[model samples]
Target: MLELRPGCECCDRDLPPDSADARICTFECTFCVDCVDNVLRGVCPNCGGNFAPRPIRPASKLTNNPPSQKRTFNPDCFPASR
Candidate 1:
């Protein structure tokens, strides 16, 4: 199952379970659309793989399969100016 991460790894932006802004690499490295387009240019910093829009879990299923509360912040993954 996808972790459905709670935030962007690069910018630390909030990405709720159903956010359309979430993007993830093959390795499940999550980031926001802003960071994926602007900072990463579709490339994942943690893995040299391309990113894809993260699938949103259905609201009904979220109760049993909760989204991950753990956040992964990696400012060094992108430029400091971001």
Candidate 2:
């Protein structure tokens, strides 16, 4: 299940679950559209991989499947040390 992160890690922009502006890398590193395209240049600053629009979790299931309580959003952690 997707954690449906609340905002961009770089700019701290609100990214509601249904937001079309949300982008995610393969490792689920979430960022805003502006950050993904302009600032990051389509390369995850942390992951070094391509990004895609994040999947929106249905609101109806909020009760059954709550969004993550994890408030941390550190893009620095997405890429594994090589």
Candidate 3:
């Protein structure tokens, strides 16, 4: 089951479960679309791989398999400016 995180790890942006701007790596490391594209340059800071938009989990399944509400914010993972 995908653990739907609540916020962007980089900029601390709010990323609700249904947020279109939410991007995640294979490891489910979540980030905002802007942070992923502009700041991280599409490179996942934790996974070192490309990111894709997070799939929205259906509400029906949410009751049975609840998404994670835990926030795993990583503030020091931004790309270094040249």
**Among these predicted structures, which one has the highest TM-score?**
1
TM-score of 1: 0.94
Q: What is the lDDT of candidate 3?
A: 0.87
**Cα shift from native, residue 19, model 2 (Å):** 0.9
Best by lDDT: 1
Candidate 3 lDDT, 13-74, residue by residue in tens: 99877789999999999999999988899999887999999998777877887778888887
Q: What shift in Å separates residue 17 of candidate 2 from its native position after superposition?
A: 1.1
TM-score of each: 0.94, 0.80, 0.88
What is the alpha-carbon lDDT of model 2 when measured against the actual structure?
Answer: 0.79
CA lDDT of every candidate: 0.92, 0.79, 0.87
Which digits, one per residue and each the tens of the lDDT, describe model 2 over residues 1-82?
8887788887777887779999988887889998887777789877689999997777898889876655546655333441
2 versus 3: better lDDT goes to: 3
lDDT of 1 by residue, 4-73 (tens): 9899998899999999999999889999999999998888888789999999999999999999999999
Segments in model 2 whose C-alpha atoms lie over 4 Å from true places: 73-82
